[model samples]
Target: MDTQQNTALTRALAEVPGPLPTSGVIHITLPHTDRFTVVGNHLAQHPDLSCTAVGLAVRIQSLPQGAKVGIKALAARCKEGEKRIAAALRELEAHGYLRRVRDRLPSGRIITRTVFCNRPAALLHPRRPAEAPPQPAKPEPAPAPAPVPMQRPAPAPVCHPTAAPPAPEVPVAPVAPPALSAPLFVPRVPPPTAPKAPRRPLPQPGELTPELDRAATTFLSDLHRHAPQFTLSEDDVRRLVPGVAAWLERAVRPDSIRRTLTDDPPQPLKHPAKLLAHRLTELLPPVPPGVDALAALDRPRPRFTVTPFQTCEDCDRAFRSPTPGHCRDCRETRAAYAQAAA
Candidate 1:
């Protein structure tokens, strides 16, 4: 009875026409009504984009506005490094899927504004005159139309099957179609730089003093505590030692350096080493002036006049003098009195 039931079930299964019909990737797609992103086929199935670039583009498209999509931010979120992410971004740019514009804020800060395009070719490519509408098919000539005896003046030599080509089965007519995560990474020729002046080489943190090295290393290693995103590797810490040492050389307090570096950092701090390097490069304070210069700046200025008003001792007259004394007239009067009495 079990065998009979198994046979019956197999028959039933074969008779039923259901979804399991192919040996390939199957889609169990559901209609997406809400919170769905529309991706263009050009980007989704671009023949030129690498797998990484395609995936990254999709991720970027699906991201909400104001989300941190910076190279560092994405690197932190995804299983990719800055270099890979950057290259992917470059691919996107080259294909017109991304644009990065440099905008100057009212505060004069230059910021990269990234724009993402679902269909970049539309904007980047010149408007192609609307493709001519396809027309109905017309019958083509037979590959080997033997000459009719009545029409032919003479019998022509027959061509080989290989020599005669068939008409195209169908005319192929395939129609073809940034908010910014970072500053333009477009490779640009660097402007001619002025000849750099020769000066004493800067002291490396390691070469300067063991104490400085120790201080820098300790600060970098412990940076993750204050800012979790700054969790750095041994190499990163080593790379950043020079920046911290620069702060030290300028006599900026270690605490001050930590505070400045850590203060209100961009959310999703992607690359701590790079962030530290930028701060070190751009925000460095001018070398703290020498003691003599500081003294000059700090010297006290008198609030009172150079010569103060003084009251005469004998005449009770006011006089301008450094020390308490009589005015000119009062002094003469006193001297006259003394001489007359003598």
Candidate 2:
């Protein structure tokens, strides 16, 4: 009895070690409930991709449509440098997992659109998925035997003097024809390439007036206090001053410019400098010519004729005003706002 008990204990201890793999992986995965991304083995386990590229591919696949996957954006999120991230992206493009197309807007703005494929092989060859291990075939049951009709005893043969043998009958084909189905297809339209626009350099440091330079510098510096994401380094501030100067030179009020920039900012802004650059360029107002441009810069910008919805600071009441500030009653003690140029 003691020997039997010892034998059982030894067998159980040995079995515990047997279940453990000598090499390879052990997974403890759970069903994803939310905030999960589906990645295919093609991208996840590519033989050619480096560890960084494979990781980036997984991250890209998991991202929702329209999400930014640029090298700079990815570098910001991951520990990799911009050059490293850029190289990884190139590797992915070469392997057919990623495609970047430069597209142009009617407004003459160019944007690079990135397309990601979870399974590149399946896209190139539709039947490639058939290479997966086939499932075990289920056993088919034997068909039931056809029932036999009972044989009627033959009637006694009647003999006729002039009976003619029946003419040979021809075999007829089956009535129904085989069904045919059309093959499935997925159509992909390539984005149209836009002609490259000539690059325009920003106004040089020497061209901007000292006053305009000061205002532009202060404007960028103040953004950090109100909107932390807009914080700029000294070099970035210097680099971007020319953009802000362009706005100031056009008779734009510092207040309005600040409001325009700070309003409805993107969440988790990756590159504030780039964001400012785009807004400064695309939102640039038409440049008024010569004497009129100089005259416009001398005075406060004209107010809108139509009163828009506004919330007052003093009373916190919603009211219609051409600009943001205290309502009429709250601002009665202060000087009246400028009316439209007449």
Candidate 3:
């Protein structure tokens, strides 16, 4: 009856989704030794050990005795950040569950070895015997020596010499004083000064010469033909003349500027002057140093070949080949027709 009851309990446990389902599979069962039990029960509940710290400890224990461990490798294996793993290792060291010994080899190399412990270090090894107090060294006695005798010298006699007589002194004449004169007058000279250079007059607004006026008129006329809505007044032309002159100075053709402004603006422009100024500054062609210097010599000249005109099939109007069979207006009309049909 006991054997039958054991078989029935095993059958029920096999149906559960856990390790018991694969009990026959190859496994290394760790013995419930004192160190293992203490690590699972006591270290897991340690106040200083966080969940991450406990998990790291378990991972370290599962490894072989002398296997290498690094913060990066451990973090990758545990799917945690390096900083968190480092913090966990530091906590383990602080709580005595880990020890890191650093030593230098004779080759002048330093290395660190990490030792994982299931229990505190004090429990693993016996306390070292207390060291004895140091005592002072004894002094040695001095030895005696023999004494020596003293000696004396003799005295000398005194002598006398003959004396000489003194002579009389002679009289001298008195000296006279010289007369003083008045001081001489002198003139002071001033330093030479440099002449001031004349300043050139600043160009006034709308101050265009005949040639510049003609160029400005032609540019304005081309711009007006392309975008009739963007009309420039006399003052506007005056404000924009410098930018147009800059383009001309760079040897940019007026036709190129006109085509650029007209050919399919990226978006519907509300301000033409600002766009023109930006284009004139950014897209201005390079100017050679002298009239004899060709631009093509420095760099290849950009090809701007005009596309062959194609007649629209629907509107019967000549248009560029970008739309192929239909012009812009016809394409919009067809789109509207399709929308209506839909």
Candidate 4:
């Protein structure tokens, strides 16, 4: 046997005790309970529980109570991705092998705890239909009243008159309208052509220096080479050229920008323009001293002048000299006899 088997055998032999009454001997036992066995069988034969979910449930059961479990930790332990672990955990929860409760602590903080129950759903949570409220008693209808008898009125007398004879009428013949000699022919007119839309003017190259233009072009070319799936339009180029120029103004080399863009971007880029714009903005260096100073000079500054004297706190009136609390007019008028003596 190999070294491992020999070591295990030696340990087993050493652990075997002699025939004597033992005291304070600790015995470890496996779960062999009927409930555990039933749970295992149910997990094995479960229709909705997948193999991964079963494995996750088993792992959760093996762990100690209140163990810290998370998606990343479980993924690393099971040698799988986080998404697969999450999906398996969700499946276990859906199949009644797990239950999650969101509880709030006294500190007003919310936390979610997952509870694993190996027992069947029937024992864990017995289904009891909600009891409906009693309906109100129906009201009694009123009885119908008796019908009344009908009454007839008296008839009036009629007057008789002689009938008049009808007169005879003469018949006339109908006249027909004259028919056209020939049918008129009309020519079909052609539809008018729509006016062509005016083209947008290209950005002036003179706005950017030769070196800046060259750097922008190089950056664009490298971007296309790295991510050929992204197609750059004229508007995109116009929007991005100023950012590139700003980088060049800050003394950032074009090659460095290209390297940063080509570095392992996320696969299946959904919005390349937005991604590129974000990267360019994030990696942009600080403005140079000369540019910052020039900008500071161009910005308008607020002006403030110091006053000659302090204003009174009560009346907010200015004085020639400083006063602690009140102005001269208010100090002369007080609720004391000192003002009367003055």
What value of lDDT does candidate 2 attain over all alpha carbons? 0.78
lDDT of 4 by residue, 10-70 (tens): 6765676664336665443445855453346777677767888888887878787888667
Model 3 Cα lDDT, one tens digit per residue, 1-342:
999999977776666664653456544344575544335577777765799999888889878767767898897687889999999988877776777778899999998978776766345354456899998887876766655655645546656566556656666666554333321111122224656655323222244467766796678756776677556666666677766765555566788867765566546677776666556556656554774465547777698978889999987899888546888899899999999999
Q: Which of candidates 2 and 4 is the stronger one according to TM-score?
A: 2
Model 2 ranges with Cα > 4 A deviation: 1-18, 126-342
CA shift of 56, model 4, Å: 3.3
What TM-score fits each model? 0.32, 0.32, 0.27, 0.31
Q: Residue-wise lDDT of candidate 2 within 52-159, one digit each (tens)?
A: 999999888878899999888898899999998999988888777788778999999999889887766655443422467879999999999999999899999999
Candidates 2 and 4: which is better by lDDT?
2
lDDT of 4: 0.68
Cα error, residue 305 of model 3, in Å, equals: 71
State candidate 2's TM-score: 0.32
RMSD per model, one decimal: 19.8, 21.3, 35.9, 24.5
Q: Candidate 2 clashing pairs?
A: none
